[model samples]
Target: MAGVLLSAAVACVLLAGAASASSSSPRVFTVGGVERGWRQPAPGEETYNHWATKNRFHVGDFLHFRYDKNDSVLVVTRDDYKRCGADRPVLRLEGGEARFRLERSGFLYFISGSPGHCDAGQRFTLRVMAQRDNGAASPTEAPAMSPGGSFNSTPGSGSGSTRMPPRGNAGDGKTSGAAPFGAYHAVGAALGVGAALLAFAPPLPATISDPPSTAASFPAASPMASRLRLGQPNPNPGLSPSPGERKGEEGEARKPEPRREVTDLGGGSEVVHIPRFMSRETAWEMFEHLDKRIPWTRPTIRVFGRSVVQPRDTCYVADKGLTDLRYSGHQPHAHSWDDFPVLKDILKEVHEALPGSHFNSLLLNRYKGGSDYVSWHADDEPLYGPTPEIASVTFGCEREFLLRKKPTNTKSQAAGESGETARKRLKASAPQQHSFLLKHGSLLVMRGYTQRDWQHAVPKRARAASTRINLTFRRVLP
Candidate 1:
């Protein structure tokens, strides 16, 4: 009893002041504090060091970076920083912009992953002051210029617990996974005193001498709210029954119960986005498996009386018996859902989320990298009936998902319209647009007249340095 009381006293003393620091809102600091973003500074420049000296970094603060498409940010070791390369990084984020959270304390080195950028002085180092700062500590170093944001993610609304996309750039704008640090803290209120003891423990190392000790886990795909996110993890990652076993699926630990948000885009149209529909781990695993297994091909599509290959690779899989299915003047070879066990499990979850959703067809799209994109258009095909609920799941990397309200006059629109006509409508005038950063393991569901009223697109982002796979589940009517 005496020992327990003594432990409690020590814990109380350690935590007495942390209540406010741990709960404080994290600060976001743009790397180098420069206008040119994360490009290399002048030869052997001092701006990065000057910037580091100017900032007061604490754990939980975010480091934001902006850079070019071909460029990348790397979380490197002290040796790598000196040698001008990171063969093994603590983390690597890509895109035009990115944000990273300082999970713990100690020195952190960041450098450019691009060939010569680091040698030319496109890097910085930071020392996260202990989290228990009393406004009287030695000046600290600032974060390096690297982005590949973790989900929980820009330092995202929370997958890497994390983005600065040029993306999640190890900050260029998309997000990554590794948010368990913040994810665990986000639920701190629910955690008991035993967990708070960590506040006094040694801060996590910021140096990248080796790869991160833990695997990167992202909780994304669903918007944060009363929306449809993925199911939560199975209590703990190391519990008796695995998430797949508990849910009767073959996936890894499921994410939090995804949340869904409905948006009314006029014309009686409704669209929903569950940013956290699926956990990043499960979604990433699915992406890896599907990329190699799915028989993907660049189907030739007729555009405005001219034959042209589609911009991205695609595969059509469905629940058997639905022949005569075609899109854009081409009929893709049909595949069965049974071929991929992961698909079957994901489909089951979709059904559970939308009790009445009857989807039998799946269109798998693979965006090899930044260049692969789908031009603007609606999914208003006759085969899908007037109003269809199409559920879209994204895995691996992040991309811009755009939804635009159609022009008031459909004077030039036509059935089976493909190609230049779509561009004309978009270029005629800038239409009202809504953008969603499609993160890994996220779900976007379009129902009601969303397809008919709003045009959706995954536009080209040259700075996007990652591959992406999207699964659109639909119901084909006979």
Candidate 2:
């Protein structure tokens, strides 16, 4: 049944080329890794299923893959062909390299031939569009590549194995009218990422990959498993009662305790502000765990108008990792959360501490050495609503926390309310001030009125500091 579905899918895609066209260069795809066999479907083996881009592909285009037949087979087909017994032939190739002319616009998928190979980890998709490209020649040969050549090293990075067709190869050497999709990894290599494979295609099913060292304690099956994978710093230092907590300016709701708070400096204007909220001891332990477990590439982020590199050790603190608090934008890699039990426990405490608070996602930022800081910004994602609650926990190093108001206009839209009435309302955004030091094992919750009115940041200090680790829990909408 699966074989028939695949065969039909291939036919439809190959025939759909006459109508629309592509706008990018013909892409040369490659695959390699643990699943060495690339061709020849093994008994009961399933095909790979995933897309190379968010958009579809058109005709006169080619998807060339250089892979091992013994490892897996790359199949290209239409979306409707995935049914158990559907007759389809998404392009199939094995051993060495093979090219398929996707002459249609629809879904394309691939699978391995080895026994249970596809079920283990071997499938991907490419949505083929139904447009024709100006007559283009396929490349004469493939390029020299490496084992990890397909992985995108940059954050929000694209795949690297796709070779742009040579000049004059496709329409002006580019696919016109086609949207750019990020690079994709081939079958064998995709399996090599070591993530647990799903027999079917649902990603959030019952099973999940084993958490890496730093995040090892939680059950791998839970959705929160993915959230602990990321985090960031102390942007808002103080906590006050959210609107729901408070009444209309009369007898207000009880405010959060300001046990350890930091103060904002010289603030009177509205701008997105983030705070550096944590103590020194806490920062070290987090790094110690990360350094011991996951592999991290030393990277820097722009914060407080300065480009600072997060040092892997204490020495580089003087050179980078320190900056002012005015401008902050930090981007760090996702941690392999396999061992950090504290995170799971901390989250549970947060939920119980503040029942109404909610967060579905998390971003992790590591300050490997002294001087790492994240600037101010409001946590106003539309999906989380006007008054979202953000729980930021800090580990390692002690840094300053500053909170300021966002510009009235930006604040208004983000707060999801308007005018003085909005201001008077005790939502997550309001002119509230507070700051606290996040020591080792410390957790802070930012709820209500905060995202609407205030912006927080963690400015870099010239002090001889240590490393810091911060995690911000959030809920992002699809």
Candidate 3:
């Protein structure tokens, strides 16, 4: 009994000492405009930062929104990120301020949910100070920083003293008119001549006339130089052009109907109705041709102690042709300038038949659709350049094309004609996939804003009607 009593007494003393130490330490800290050297929270973003030092904030810490030229503040975070405990704290601006208690801890991020504000770069962070006592006071005092340190809300809003040096620089933000670092500046005369040549180079094939026959003429050359010189109306005008000659002149400018008809799908979508777009016979022929070549092999990648098989393939490359037609479970076919001969022929033929588009490169997707499918993804590869045009041709079994808009916030939905709200619009100008029966011999063109704002997929079919082959034409980086 004596030993037990003594042990209890000592334990009590240790506990008391710990409690005393915690009570004396400062637990509460404040974060706001005072800490973030800014006049307002990034013009339109909701700033973020903790009120305590380190990861120590707990329930009851107050968050404040300062007065600024702007009206209100909104906090936003991705649904997945939020569920993962990395979302920004949810707080609102009303009357003069808003507050939120730190109920939990982990990595958290946030942004202003205002009109295009977050897209403008309004972001911040907060690392709560470790808690020493549960009785820590609320965030009521102003944050402290050394002299020369201050907040600038619009610069980059948040509850931290992250500052930017005066005299705007590339590091401060994106530079507007500065030339590239280490740019090649040629000799004065040589550079001047080169610039002039580039500026005045012919915009298209020489066969094309200066002014287009329609109102949408390619604005080639200066408008003044290309203006038609019309002789004075009646002063000495000869008898009005004979009927035959008059009709000839008018017919010269009248656009010809596309030899290949286009099936107008309701809702502004249309498909090239060329007879050879695809057919059962063509699909079987392509399969036979591919079967004679080497089969595709899957490429493997190791990640986190596991081997990840990427789209892979195995092909025999010869000066003349490839001998393999198999899915390699990889993407982006290996093509080079050497392939230009055949490619040029293909482009020439297409150009002669359909004069509205031009092809620069070819991207081959070997989907030996034996047992796999590509997940939903956007092909925004930069090499394609901005507003790149693409053509997709399919050979073999028919399959469904699945396309969906990039999901976004409801409040930020884009408005379109008919005043309908759309999360995404088809490059064809409608918010739907213009599905085609991409049969053998069929070709589909994804031009205009396709890559700029939409995504596409060729999902794996449970009972694939039949094995299919797809080829996509693109303009690789020059």
Q: Which candidate wins on lDDT?
A: 1
Evaluation by TM-score, superior candidate among 1 and 3: 1
> lDDT tens string, model 1, 1-478?
5456446645544443244344343566778664767887652233364466457676556677777757778886656766767687756767656766665445577888888777655677765643433432332333333333333223323233123222132333433433334534534442345345435454322221211222122222222210222122221222332333333243333324556787777787777888888654345436655775677899899888999989899988887777557777998888777676557777888888778898999999999989999988998989898998999988887999999987675444633566787767646756789988888988888888988778989999998888899999999997
Query: lDDT tens string, model 2, 353-373?
Result: 556665545556666554656
Model 3: number of backbone collisions? 37
Candidate 3 lowest-lDDT run of ten: 208-217
User: Which rank order by lDDT, best down to worst?
Assistant: 1, 2, 3
Looking at model 1, report the run of 10 residues with the lowest lDDT sum. Answer: 206-215
Model 1 regions more than 4 Å off: 1-256, 410-430
Candidate 3, residues 1-478, lDDT tens digits: the string is: 5455444444443343343333223223334445552223332122232122123443223344553435344433334222322234344333323333232222234444444433333333332222423443443532322233222233234423222122222254522112222221222333344334434442222121111111110112222332222112222222232233323332321113333645444433334544364333323333433433324455674445666775423332222242222322333345443433333433554555556665555544455664555555655677666666566666666666665554444443344422333433423344455445555666666555556556777776666645565655655445
| TM-score (C-alpha) between model 3 and the true structure | 0.34
Give the clash count for each candidate: 85, 135, 37
What do the candidate models score in CA lDDT, each in turn? 0.65, 0.41, 0.40
Better of 2 and 3 by lDDT: 2
Q: Lowest summed lDDT over 10 consecutive residues: which window, candidate 2?
A: 211-220
For each candidate in turn, the TM-score is: 0.46, 0.31, 0.34
User: In candidate 3, residue 69 scores what lDDT?
Assistant: 31
